[model samples]
Target: MALTVPRLLAARAEAEPAHIAISQGADTLDLAAWQARTQAIAAGLRAAGIRPGERVGLLYGPRDWIAYACSYTGVLAAGAVAVPMSVRSAPAELAYMLEHCDARALVYGPAAKPPDVPVELCWGPERISALPEAEPIPGPRPGDAAQILYTSGTTGRPKGVVAAHANLTHGARLNPPLRALAHSRHFLHAFPIGTNAAQTMLFNALTAHAGMLATARFVPEHFARLIERHAVGTVFVVPAMAIELLRSGALERHDVSSVALFGSTAAALPPTVAAELAAAMPHATLVNYYTSTEAAPTQTSMVFHPARPAALGRAAAGGTLRVCDEAGRPCPAGVVGEVWMRGAGIPRSYLDDPETTRHVFRGGWTRMGDVGYLDAAGYLFLVDREGDVIKSGADKVSTIAVEAALHEHPEIVQAAVLGLPDPVLGMTPVAVLVATRELRLAEVRAFLAARLAGHEQPSRIVHVDELPRNAGGKVVKHRLRELFDAAPDPRT
Candidate 1:
């Protein structure tokens, strides 16, 4: 049988009928209820003229738990592909996606107000109840499209990456091992479900019969309470949220003893912050995984090991990774190169951009555009994005390396390093930092001088309360470049 979302839900409903499938604060839905609601919503969409292979956009906040799931599953159940957009996205961004996807219908929560679309279905418990119940329509083939995800577009316009049913299910099965998700685990999903991480969590929860809880928005205090209340076993958080939890002193006050695993993704988690988290949640296992929207979970490392702070782990199950030079030849261990991955789990290509799709995804191997190297032990260590690698003087410096060095300082909470245009050196390295306590330039320079090579160190260090980041907790380096370029040149 082809692996599909509805099929997984049906199997869970049959085997774990009474199991708590989802929880929204005081409200909870068993597997049976979840399946029924999804089917009902699917029937409503069918009745409204949504056909198989059509694209439907799901616009809802993080909280509206069941509604969002119902909308996503409903689209799939009706033989349509679901395109989930971030609630934090600006109207213009949403409009661009909607137009690009040529979405046939938009299923939005009660609170959402999308500008213009062919069809708009208001979704809520009451609205869902009013719709007629219908059986799920099986239309997706193994090779048929399952989802269309927008890349982070750190450099240029975001491209729509399409995943087939086979690719998505295979990747979903592989992710649990990478993040160590178990059947008995209870996962708290506070991040936007539109992203790849959210998709992985949803798939794993349903497949493994794990209890999933969601919050409308990420509130540090509420997250703590939910962990205690639900006995959540695992959680996926971004670096920003981790820093906020550390600063707010919220994790210290709550009984988060039930949390066994904490996973960080979307951005690099500084060793200093990881150490702080390890101190706060001493009993929990902290693992960091790295991947992008174009790819699924690629590498991961378990916390509390001697090598924990050194490198990301090996390639996930069913995936193969290589560090290759400009000519696509494999690089020796300890030498940084472009990270390339190939497996059944990797997505085929971008949705519409054939040229870019061919450029990035070549002959079943997908180029992550990230620079990293593997150790003799086969562990992958990420340095920086290929485009973001700073060329200062004659040295090629990884911004991630500089950022890691800066984050080692006691006063520095977070740091971002990027390359700025320079007439003499082609590009010069600049660093921006956020600090928990007062920090001085001399202290930062001294700290890096002890850790990084002379050429790898940033020429200028700017202090800020917080670094500008996107929804995924990745430092918006483009925005940082704008700010950095506008500042008066230090050499002048």
Candidate 2:
């Protein structure tokens, strides 16, 4: 029995020593070779003084998935908690994360400009495979902290969620005979390191009947080319990536019929995007998954219901979910409340933050902190984030409601809504849009006048070339507020 991911990986290496386990462009590695490299990195970390229970920082960039995989597993083998930081993060953000986690050693990719830490190792892509091979160290205990993945820090500084060895191993303990992933020879995704989506893809590779194929960065054309070149049967992407693939006209340009399953996660798929994807890939089943970094892999998956495109499906096997009112009581069907869930994959708590840990982690359940409701058929419907709700003079408006309305416009590619200071209303709604053409505030107000209530309508509108996103494709809401607020609002 596999108590951890590295142990399962080791078992696979013994069972299928020569089978190809990973492929990217021209690079490929068989199970035995991959296992040996992971073990070598593990031994290297131990020799470099990575102690058990210590937090080790990881900064592998997008170019090489192999480095991320080997180094991550190596940290577990060494029994140190891995702290994976985004390579895209600013220096200060990176510094804060390392300092907050009390990271002893920073294992970074060549491109990463890590902070001033006690110890640092620069494992360039070329050098990752050449590290001296060494014997395997002791395996991790089930209750031990395996990794620390940071959240978006929307409310405060990014919080690090600590995953136990059992939590990290949940995704790979998959049952065989999956409908979509099992039939595919290769599954393709473009998630960056330091995100659970990327980690889940790697787990799918180990558990399912596919060799994981990945791109260093997400380029729509490049993604299309890979699908055509590899005859990829299954592909998973964020909703933004799917929307890009649709907008780029790459679906029509590339012969991507080999794709049988199109999966999406990180955020709910816009109705327009979901409908277009279904029409574009008629042969494929569109799946939307819902889960957070804290309750990862143990997700709610919906097989794109034509009638309920917005519904985030039912709890996955071995997962439990419920919609609860403020008092923590389960809400009846069709009632909005907080979404709470628990699964073997759910992290134990946020590292070093007992207050936050106590706030969200109750018994074995994790409060998802999102406003949602369950449907009559037991499906979950996510309405808005509790923190993201906008308040007007006399009404509380959901940001999702405004964003959904904006998505209805053909010219609007993406939209984010937030509350702004208003003398008359105390707090008024504002919109930041990524559009194909310049949009005036009057144009937005007129378009949404009939669709939304007067108070719910965006009082200010700002246009941007692109909405900034993290590695997982979630909009960095704070950045939008900072960068777009200063833009001249046509209303003024």
Candidate 3:
């Protein structure tokens, strides 16, 4: 069979039908049931005219993890493409993704109202449980499009990064799974679906041979409780979740000693946070990996060095990392340059965007736009993204996206957004604006609260007579940062 995941899933069902495959809150589903439901859902899609190679959208919340997993597998089982979108995505963002991927169907959780789409299904609360179990269809081959994950790009528009079936399952099936993960009985994570992180969690659920547990929204306390109650042995969080867990002091409140492995990705783990995470999970091994939308499945390996807690480990199994200067020549140890990666199973292009794909994907390597250097030992270190993509805590806040949201208010004429160093979060987003009306930080926040996520909203806003701009008409972010630093608060 050409299916990497569905094959393992089928094996899990036949070998350990009763084993808990996934759990959320008090709800749990076993491998056999999930398999049956997945097949039934696939049949449902086929019945609805979703043919092979057609793209199907999945917009699911974490609480509905069972439905989410089933839908993901169902689309693949039918040999159709899966395009996952964030439930928190703005309507415009959803519209852009559905249109860009040319999705044929959309599946939403019960808690969320289905977006405006032609063919939609509410795979709501316990709905998958009722579907008749249909025979599983033949799965896709290695070259078939398994998924199209849309990530925010430098231009602030969503770009659909397509992955082959092999690329989708390569990272998880790597021989000699991480020690802590392999021995674990249950794995807990709070990643939102539609993210690469979430897909990794999905792979773990399918093949880790451990029950995968998740929460709807990542609040520190809720995550702590899940670990305490489930005795979760392996857990994964993005840097933002780690920061909140530390700042909230939630670890101290719960008995989380059962956790033996803690992992973070999606952003660099701050050394301070790394040290604190060590203190919090003294028994668990803390590991982080570096990857991008284009350079993924190929990633650095699990690393744990108390001496250099922030170091992203060496190239992952069957992966290679290189640091090259502007001329594309390899840089010597400790010399900064662009980080490029080639994972054996990494996909090659963005769907239908040959120009952009060709720019980043070259010679079987992905040019990760972040600046970084490799040590003599070959560990990668990141300085920053090449542009105004704000690495605010764990969230990849797009300055352009935030500015676009701010521009939605006609009161704001021109806005320049930048990142400020924060102790708790690695960075906090700050905005300096030239507005037509009196705009306060609270007003700016209130305006964006509806448009962007909480982390994307500026922690601080400053008013200026006019934003310093280069002759090319791009607002100079460094000059804007200097302006914000010089004035604690500016009044127009």
Candidate 4:
């Protein structure tokens, strides 16, 4: 049934040897070719003394996506846990992840800089390709550990999420497979390697009917041109990329009508941006995919409907969703609470932190760390991150709701709301904006007045060229707070 990734590759290679599995610009790999590379890499790892169940770090840049994909598969085939790391990560961060996972070896690509962390061995594309292809190694069970993915360290050091083979292959073996973008011959995305969103794209390449086409980096004009050039049927992006695509007028310049499905993931899509996307790709289904590194493969996806612009969508992918109170009891419809999800796949945990593991993954449900509410129809609407909620005087404000309101303003190109320490109010909501032109605080306040409650409105405003974002396109709120720290007190 191909329950594990290795088994899936073997099955697909045998079933459709000539089928194109993935491509990056001029580089393409058929199922058979990819399988051969995977086997050779696995043989090399075995020869390097990388044992089963040990962690092996994969360092690769965006342009080396194909090599990274094959290397990751090879690690699994050799029964070793794959640790995917991005070259974009800070050297210290990369070193920490490799050292934390106790990696046996590091496999790197030409464009990647291997971390200085001590490991038994390091192999690059040249050496990896030189290894003789051996027959497939055995003994990887579906229940065994598969990969370790690190979360963006917005608040603290990045934590590794350990996903088992079952988690990655959850729905791969269904009698009637559920293929994403089933109508498309090719799906295109510029997601950075090592992100949860990018991991999903990898799985789609292995299981979906379409070929996965990826760009080395995301340039709005280039992205749009690729869609038009290939007549791409399915597309994916984060909200930041979508914003750029619209702001750069790429949609107007390029013929992107070939795209039938447009998906956004990694963060909640602001209602304003979703509306703009719907307007630009009128025929395409605009979907928002909401999930975390901890609750992956189990997510909720919504097709953009003008009537329910804020809904994240009901649970999909054989998973269940609920909004629960502090004690973990389910909240009634429309009541804001912590969000949690339970998927058919095995529950993931923090790599080595049992205390945090107990706090986040409870009773088979992964706490999403975001505050949200479920509607009567079960659609979820995010309020704010648990840490980002603003406590102003006796009232609480949702940063997400405030940001959504700010995005609707015509002059605002980007907006991030965060709590700033206030002498009188303890903490107050502040708006950091990237605007088309200078806007008076009074004018911005008046604009948000009708959209937000008094307490939800920002007490002060700050202007920036752009909001600082992580690789996955999520705003780094702490960095925004740092900006306010360097400035004169707003209360003054």
Candidate 5:
């Protein structure tokens, strides 16, 4: 069995040389071709004076997924840590990540516009491919740091989450090896190259029997068309894409009946939206995956069930899940608390922030920073992020609950709940949504009256064409607060 990425590539190349490993549009790399590319890149990096254990920044666009994947594996093959970065990020953000990791070199694609970072070496795909192929120094081990993936940084600056080779491979070393979505022949995902979710897809390409397919970027129409064109059997999406697919009526226009396994990740899929997706793709099995950058490879997955729409599944991949109080003691069943996950893989930590590392990675468990509860049957149900809970007057309102309630309304396609300042009630819940048509505040409230309490209901409603999201498709709630600030205060 392959214990590291380099070994995994060699094994796959030897076993399935001509099998397509990854594809993007007309570009496809077979296992043998991918291995050759990585070998050339690894030799090139070594010839460029990049030493073992050095960090190398991989800057690429979404369309540059093939190059980025080669760079990542090649860096590992050369016994260096790969810091995956997105060209979509601002120059300053990219520079910060490169400097944070003390990158020794940078590998960029043709389309990727990298910032002015002072690294020892900067090479593009053409330069790396031109290098003579040679064997790389074998030194990277299962416990060695493999990659540094930055968090979405919705609340603050992005923090790099460092993962070891073992953490990334999960159970690749085991006998009868545990592969990702082994049942399918092809899986499709539109996640950007820099995110943890996208990294998981890359791993799937290396380990799974399925060929991985990605878009140049995520366009709802293009996304649906790819599924139909490729007859993609397993498809992965974030909640935002799922909502857009439903909103744009893309699935209706395309024949997506070939999708047998539909997976949603990055955030909790709203139950109402999940139900709608199930109806649209009746042939596919809908699964929701819940995990954070810090607690990766260890996640909870729930198959959509009408009876338990809110449950986020139980601990998966032999991981432990707990809801703990302020002091870190596990809360009893049905009580809301901070969610934490612990898997067999090595615990990941922040790159430079020791304070945050200590706070988030404690005793082999990564604090998920989510407030949720576990039922008697061990199913997990998230209420809200610990910071997102609205403290209105003496009551606390879950933004997730209010958003879920808002989604139930046929007129609303997407909704985000946030707290805006109120003189009388500390902070009041406000709903910013994308609706099919103009909706009266009275009708929305009348609809929510049966579903939510007085404090839980939004004090005001703001209609928008779309919700502000980071590249990973997570709703940036802080941006939503700005919308409330611009509008005049409305009566509740």
Candidate 6:
């Protein structure tokens, strides 16, 4: 049978009726119960006037196990597209999304209130008394819009990237070696379900017959305790959480041997950080995927190859990747250019943003605005984001490359590099570092001198206890620039 999200759940319900399907601390639900709850929620959504092709926004906390799965399946079962909005989204931003998507209904939890929409439903652990188990709707075609994920809005206001059912399902079928070896029976997710990583995790788990463990937020101590308490086999984490787990010594204290697969996304995984995690959790395989929210996940590195830290592995299943110049022609191997992807798994367009959609989803190929190159062996090497490139004295330096170099130093725990306004150079690269131990600017400069060209080195280095990061592990460069502007100049 062709695999669809709801169909996968239904098959699991019959095949593994008694098997655990989801767990959160002390709470657990088997496949039978999970399917029933999802069906009931689907009926409720249909009753609430949700129709096929209409957008339904889900603004809820992470830990409500029943609601989380039911909400996702409910939208699909009702034949409506699910738009999972983060609980952390500002009210204005939420309002704009609701208006932009023309969302017909909203399902929210206690933490997030629905915007002024005609239909709103509140859900929690308590089962809805009136909801009935509804029949699953006919499976959607491959090209139907399955989800609309919002980007970080780094360049401008966020645009909703519309992903088709085929785009999501294709990735779901290709079982990565890490997940397969771990026998990932339980998926522990700390990231928000609204994001691409969370969505991918849920889809993959359901298809693999794995239970999902949800958490409201990431608290190092709490997360470690939960991992130990529940024999969670798979965990989806970000770089910030990985750094904290290493720094807090939580991994040493917790018995997380059941955690066999450790996957990271949304940011670059520094080689130093990956090494630390490998040392701490010798039983687990560390995997990192590099992709934008716009294109879904393009490439993934399931194993650490020290010689190729920048490679995002080969293209994911059903996808083709090409690094092309501004004219859309493929560049030579080892040369940097914008990454382009074409496949059944690529998104159709951006919701309600025709101009942006036309620019990105041009002629069936999704243009990922990241500048990167492919090696001779077919491994992808990401240089930096197109917008984040720093131009210094006729040279364009990748901020990510400089940050990755800084992170390799033993004393530096985390690093973020950004462009600073410079009169002499169009923009100069400045490194902001979070030090694990005492570090000096001179020592940092000397360390980079050997690894990087003179122009790629940062003109100034600042040490801070921590760098600002969003929930997805991406450095908020906008906030970093603001902080830099607010600081009193040491030169003065």
Question: What TM-score against the true fold does each predicted structure earn?
Answer: 0.92, 0.94, 0.78, 0.97, 0.97, 0.90
> What would the per-residue lDDT of candidate 4 be over residues 1-492, giving only the tens digit for each residue?
438898888888888899888999799989998899898888878878988999999988998888998999999999999999877789999999999999988999999988788998888878987888788878489999999999988888999999999999987764335565678989999988888888999988988888999998999999999999999999999988888898889999999999999999988999989999999999899999999999988999999999999889989988999999988899999999999999877989999999999999988899999999999999999988998898899998899889999989988888889988777889888889989998877899999989998888887788999788776778888888777777565457
Report the Cα lDDT for residue 129, model 2: 59
Point out where model 4 deviates above 4 Å: 174-178, 489-491
In candidate 1, which residue ranges exceed 4 Å CA deviation?
A: 117-127, 171-180, 183-185, 297-304, 485-490
Looking at candidate 5, the ten consecutive residues that score lowest on lDDT are 173-182
Per-residue error for 416 in candidate 4, Å, reads: 0.9
Clashes of 3: 0
All candidates in order of lDDT, best leading: 4, 5, 2, 3, 1, 6
Those runs of model 6 whose alpha carbons end farther than 4 Å from true positions after fitting are 1-3, 116-129, 137-139, 171-182, 436-440, 463-465
Model 5, residue pairs in steric clash: none
TM-score ranking from best candidate downward: 4, 5, 2, 1, 6, 3
Candidate 5 C-alpha lDDT tens digits along 361-478: 9988999999999999989999999899999999999999999999899889899999988899999999998999988778899999999998898888889998988878888899
Q: Determine which window of 10 residues in candidate 6 has minimal summed lDDT.
A: 173-182
Query: What are the lDDT scores of the predictions, listed in order?
Result: 0.76, 0.82, 0.77, 0.89, 0.88, 0.75
Model 2 lDDT tens row, 1-492: 337877878877887787776787788877888788888878877777778898888898787677777778878888888888878777788888888888877777766776655555544455655778878888788778988999876666788899888886765543333523667889999998888788788777666678889898888898998999989999999988997898788898998899998999988888768888999988888999998988875789999878997888999968899999999999999999999988855456888889989999888788998998899999998888888877777888888878878887888888888888787778888888888999888888898888898888888787788887876788878776775456665555
Q: Which parts of model 3 have CA positions greater than 4 angstroms off?
A: 119-130, 153-155, 171-180, 388-492
**Residue 163 shift from truth in candidate 5, angstroms:** 0.7
For residues 225-313, could you state the per-residue lDDT of candidate 1 as single tens digits?
88887788888788778877787778988898887888887776777778878888988888877777776644444454544575677
- Per residue, candidate 6 scores C-alpha lDDT tens digits across 46-98 of 77676678888888776654566677877776677888887676778888887
Q: Write the per-residue lDDT of candidate 3 for residues 231-250, one digit (tens) a residue.
A: 88888887656766876779
